[model samples]
Target chain A: MTGAPQDPADAEACPVAPTLWLRLEADGTYRVGLTTTAARRAGAIVHYRGPVAGRAYAAREPAASLESEKWVEHLALPLPGTVVEVNPLPTADPGLLNRDPEGAGWLCRVLAGPTDGRAAPPSVPTGAPE
Target chain B: MSLEPSDEARPGRLPSWRLLDLGRCAPARAQAFVEAVAVSVGEGRVPNTLVLAQPSAPYLSLGFHQSFHEELDPGFLERRRIPVLRRVEGGGTTYLDPDQWFFQLAYRDEGGGRGGPEDLKRFLRGPVAAARSLGLSAELRAPSDLVVGGRKVSGNAGGDWEGAHLVVGGFLLGADVRAMADALRLPHPALRPLLRGLVAREVTSWEEAVGVRPPWERFRQALASAIATEGRFEARTGAPTPAEEARFLEETLPRHSDPAWRELPPAPRRAGSLVRRLRIAGPHGLLVFRGSGEHLAAIVDGDRLVEAYRVGDGPTDALEELGEDGDGRAAVAELVASTPSFA
Candidate 1:
């Protein structure tokens, strides 16, 4: 549903994926952004590499790469999809993923399909925060 | 030109010495090769000495416990079109291209000889002697690096699994120095220049540096000679054995390419969350409590609250999501609390 697009001015004031950011675009595609906790758990986001456009990726295929200050990580997709477009600039500079994860740092755009119930969001029950 | 008996060199004979040539194949095959070897050695069906050559591919490898996000700029890597690969062994990061020749040596040894001169001497002898047999005059430097004329041409690392050892190394055979330096997250400011110097001082490839197209057979012979292995070396040329196949899938596959493993634990041990979904009987019977960012988000202990702490975003959601099972919640909360911005 198209609610009034959150104002850029308002978005700047709002916290970004404080717990975790999950987005379901108008086309029924879901995008999940890491909470700062997730990012921190992943170390520093040093690099963000995404799939090429027009390529179909299986669920849990590496969706992106993250190189934090301490290590290098591959971010796997939870669902299958065709890579529609990648965040162009972030591939040239990975710090954006670490610094602005939900904004300019968002890694890839996938036209995702259901995973036949094989994969669910990691088992984090609602109301229980760790 | 056939060599006379007097001109022939004596080959080193090491019982476990085995060499594998993976004729042009995908990167996954290389991974599978190592896993197969690991399984064979683990089961006592094979000796420890195994050498595997990874075919050319656009791949980057990271050490065990290294985080992808922490060490590299994913954007830069993507722009250059390099795929990141995680290997079974532990070490720092490395880059592998078609021009590069990758070699892994699997030995069966526990940590008894680890960090000892004998282990280092044994590990370096194969590659070092191989290089010399090819007439390159290479030598082993301190630690594990191999230096040829003062330049480093190879880097090595290994770990033991169930009394079986796996040591793998990479030889820069006509590798792109600028590309490798660019790809890895280096620890020292001087790494690039130092690596360039090391490459110059240590390694000589068949195509460019050696002035001769050293065929793959030459590499194999050199390796065999160094290790004193006299057995008839043949290419594996087939799929892994069933037992090997199963063990590789079980022990190496999941962690090989998984991002969760690539991104290691973020917090110090104490700061790590102790997530628990199921009931636990500590001071009281089956105490249930929800926590957030190191504080108790909510508590319900057998219909009464014995203790409670502040419920932040972390503890509140973790408790609810982890309902009944009581898994890794506490660790997550403590980790979240220690983060810089959370305070």
Candidate 2:
């Protein structure tokens, strides 16, 4: 169930929800962030409530809630894993999601589970990470 | 155009759509109907539709995530007998009545792949053009607001429901600014004049923006025509099916009327939570500061300070430098020290 590498130059993305990108780091953690398209669609994110560090969320379960002036959306990790770190930048200045969504606006980093690389499009479950 | 199948067919091989004009419905029914259409379109049971509705009675509509306790004055609402209902869409609280015309456009996701902002801009162009056709200069502002002469004439809210893209906005033909001010709980009692002034500066109605107020029916026809022409859809008049109406009665009505939905979830208590109120001397006049948690909001009389610069959310390095003791007076002093003196 590994996601096909869409871009050989960078991170692999879920075809269903191209807005979500997962990059596997050297330490076996997948750094996850919303693509610019997702960020723009969500509007200006004014608040972020988390996938707490050390907490493991199941696949399709909400990992974080992003609130904008006009909408609130729940974003889930494509693969279930223990959250290693959560970005503090968005909590301080939620505008970063719109200003620099792909870079500094990374939502959280999760320790890779056995099946962390699979594509879990927002529409369908790609099975929980082992 | 007649209701015949051939007449209903759209010209230019475009999709034909319905325009449901549910004129002057009860407050609860108005909310229910919009939700019904959104659900129907999302499920692909209904055609891409445009709905026009107006509440027969005055009521306060709360945005989906807004807390009723924090946003509205309950006593005022109770005394006035104005029912407060929470909408499924996200936006700030609004007071609605027959004087305003409400429009909602629901579309099946066509894979256009545009973001919310772009979608909103595209949806608004029709209304803006309709306003312009009436000889009023109107423009769409970012994040879904329609304005004339830089003052908002329409406020919009939108989101994806089920699988349908729903955008709802209202045009204020006439509004009671004073009643709107009294309905909301401002930070201080002394801020009423300030609120009125702010509203006067920011909001304009159709009658005020244009010289004459066209009849609501005329406005609706103009808007529908403009939208159909711009979006390339033939507008056919129709109503919700029996199943959709049943769904609204059984499901949407009860969910929106639930009392618990009006309140925000309780925030977790944190240790060392500082709540402070302090009065500081400002360049224009006395400024009152209310600081709590990581955010601070200030109130000041006069137009000297631009509205945007008056509020600060989350403490900055300057506030942290005041000391770890979290003294209210000390924080005020530190803030005043950094603020430039207005001579």
| Alpha carbon lDDT of each predicted model | 0.47, 0.63
B1-343: candidate 2 lDDT, tens digit per residue: 2234454354556566778888889887765577677667756677778888888988888765455776786667878888788765666678887788888887766422232545677778889988898877889866677888867788887765544566788888887767766677655454545556556666788989886787878888989988777776778888888877887787667666666645533222122322221111111223334555333323332323332112344223222222324464345545544443322
**How do the residues A2-104 of candidate 1 rate in per-residue lDDT, one tens digit apiece?**
3433322233222422223445566555444444445545444433445456665554344444443222333444446666655555555555555776767
RMSD of 2: 9.1
How many clashing pairs per prediction, in order? 74, 0
Interface RMSD per candidate (angstroms): 13.3, 8.2
User: What is the lDDT for B170 in model 1?
Assistant: 58
**CA lDDT, candidate 1, residue B183:** 65
Candidate 1 chain A: 10-residue stretch with minimal lDDT: A121-130
Clashing pairs in 2: none
lDDT of 1 by residue, B1-343 (tens): 1112342234542233344555555665564467567556645565444555655576777654445665565655778776676554444566667665656555444211332223544666777877777766667764456765555566665543322445667566675655555564433232234334433333344445465545667776567555443222222223345666666566456555565555543221122332321111111111112344333322233334332333334322222233432445454344334422200
Provide candidate 1's TM-score on chain A: 0.61
TM-score of each: 0.47, 0.68
Q: What is candidate 1's local distance difference test score?
A: 0.47
